[model samples]
Target: MWTVGHSTHPLEDFVALVRAHGVHHIADVRKMPRSRRHPQFNVDTLPAELGSAGIGYTHFAGLGGLRREQPDSVNRAWKNPSFRAYADYMQTAMFAAELDRLIALGAREPVAVMCAEAVWWRCHRALIADALVARGEPVLHIHTPQRAEPHVLREFARVENGRVTYPGEPELF
Candidate 1:
């Protein structure tokens, strides 16, 4: 499995980007699959566009970002509030079910999870990648048509019993 970002690319370029990674299915992980800046990626048109290219598309809103942070979140390793919030969301049963669905899809096909951010490190896909890695799934972050880097667990990430948590405290991580 892999993760890619459309990043305002033209439709053809985005398709090529996924094709380069042998991704036959794209599990769109955007909370809202619309792009005012790049309408070509809007949900209404993307499925058809990707279909013509022989790549499948499915929107996994359950794995979407922009979640609200729990006031009691312990994922302080992420100074960025959004990342901290998303880490908390990962603990939900909803997230586990959604992630299981994604893993099942990957078993049947080469899957690429995608969002809007150009860089994986800056996207919620980073945390998603962490969860995947903790489960022993290989995840690569696609950077270009010819370049992809395998995801490495973040420095502060701690995995216990197949769950990953980022406790900011250096002593515990």
Candidate 2:
């Protein structure tokens, strides 16, 4: 499986990048698929644009980010509130269901999980990749048409029974 961020690329360029990686399916993992700054990437228009280029797009809002962190979150290793919130969400059944769906799709086709961040480490896709890795799936981060990097689970990540968490001891004041 592969991951890529639309990252303000022109619609044509994004299509080309995915095609270059032999990606037949794109799982849109953006909580809000619409991009006001890049109207071309709006949820309503992306499927057709990608379809015209022989690619399939599926928006998996269940796998999307923008989650709210619990007041008592176990994934405290993530310093960023957004990342921590997403890590917390990963523990829910909804995320598991969507992840299963994505895994099944990937098993059948060359799939790339798509989001809006320019890099995987900076996006929740990294956590998703960690989950995939925990399941023994190989994941690659597509940086460009010619450059793709193998995904390495975050150092702070803790995986158990195919689930990932980022736990840390609270600092004593």
Candidate 3:
């Protein structure tokens, strides 16, 4: 499985990137599928556009970002409030169920989770990648049409018994 950011790429470039990575399906993880700045990537158009290119697309809003931060968030490793909030959401059963769907899709075909950020580290996709990595799932972050890098779980990430968390304190071990 893989993750790709739409960034500001042209539609063709995005398609080429997906194709180059052998991604047969895209699980759009944007909370809102519409991009006022890039309407071509909107839900109404993206699915058909990908279909025309012989790739599949699905909006998995359940995996989308923009989650509320818990007043008592445990993901203190993330200084960025938004990232910390997403980390909190990752602890929910809903997130697990939705991620299971994504994993199942990858089992059937190559799937790339998509978001608007240009890089995985800046997006909630990184947390998703952490969850995948914790489960022993391999994930590649597609950098360009010709470049993809294997995911490395965040340095501060603690995976104990298959649960990923980012506590502020350094691990004693």
Top-lDDT structure, candidate number: 1
lDDT of 3 at 131: 94
Tens-place lDDT digits, model 2, residues 1-173: 99999998999999999889999999999999999999898999889988988999999999999999998899989889999999999999999999999999999999999999988989999999999998889999999899999998888888999999999778578
Runs off by more than 4 Å, candidate 2: none
In order, the Cα lDDT scores of the candidates are 0.94, 0.93, 0.91
TM-score (all chains, Cα) for each model? 0.96, 0.97, 0.95
Q: Give the lDDT ranking, best first.
A: 1, 2, 3
Better of 1 and 3 by TM-score: 1
lDDT, candidate 1, 70-132, per-residue tens: 988878788999999999999999999999999999999999999999999999999999999
Instruction: Order the candidate numbers by TM-score, best to worst.
Output: 2, 1, 3
Clash count for each candidate, listed in order shown: 0, 0, 0
**Clash pairs of candidate 3?**
none
